[model samples]
Target: MAMAAEEIEALITGGIPDARVEITDLAGDGDHYAARVVAESFRGMPRIKQHQAVYAALGGRMGGVLHALQLTTAVPE
Candidate 1:
C-alpha cells in the first residue's frame, strides 16, 4: 500500500523523536513525497548523515514500498 502523509510523518518522528516534521505529497499517487524535518538530533551531523538517519528509519522499505522521497533536514533553532 502507498503510504499516507501521516504515516510518513510518524516514521520520521519515530526516527528523530524530537523533530518538527512536515510531509507533502508531491503526487496524488502517494509515491512522490517531500519532507522537511527539523530536529536537535540533526544539529551536528552532516547533511548526508541526517538523510541517512531518516532512511534508516524506513529499514528495508526504501525501494519496495517507498519511492521518491525529497528530503530536507535542518537543525532546530
Candidate 2:
C-alpha cells in the first residue's frame, strides 16, 4: 500500500507538534516522496538525527507502505 501525502504530514505533525512539514510526491506515485520538515526541536541536533526524527514519526513505514523518501530537515531560522 502506498501512503498519501496528508497521511505522512499528519503522522509527522502528530509526532512533532511544532513541526512545519512540506511533502511532495516526486514521482506522481504515493510510493515516492520528498519532505522538508522545519522545527525548533531540530536545533543542535545532527543532520542524521534530524532525519531519524522524521523517520521515527512515520512509525517504521519507511520501507513498507511508504517506499522512497528524500527528506530534509532544519531548525527554524
Give the top-scoring candidate (lDDT). 2
Native-to-model Cα distance after best TM-score fit, residue 9 in candidate 2, in Å: 0.2
lDDT of 1: 0.87
lDDT of 2 by residue, 1-77 (tens): 89999999999999989999999999998899999999999999999998999999999999999999999999998
Task: After superposing candidate 1 on the true structure, give the runs of residues whose Cα lies further than 4 Å from its correct spot.
Answer: none
Model 1: residue 13 alpha-carbon error in angstroms: 0.8
Q: Give the per-residue lDDT digits (tens) of candidate 1, residues 23-72.
A: 98998899989999898988889999999999987676677788779999
Candidate 2 residue spans exceeding 4 A from truth: none
Candidate lDDT values, in order: 0.87, 0.95
| Residue pair clashes in candidate 1 | none
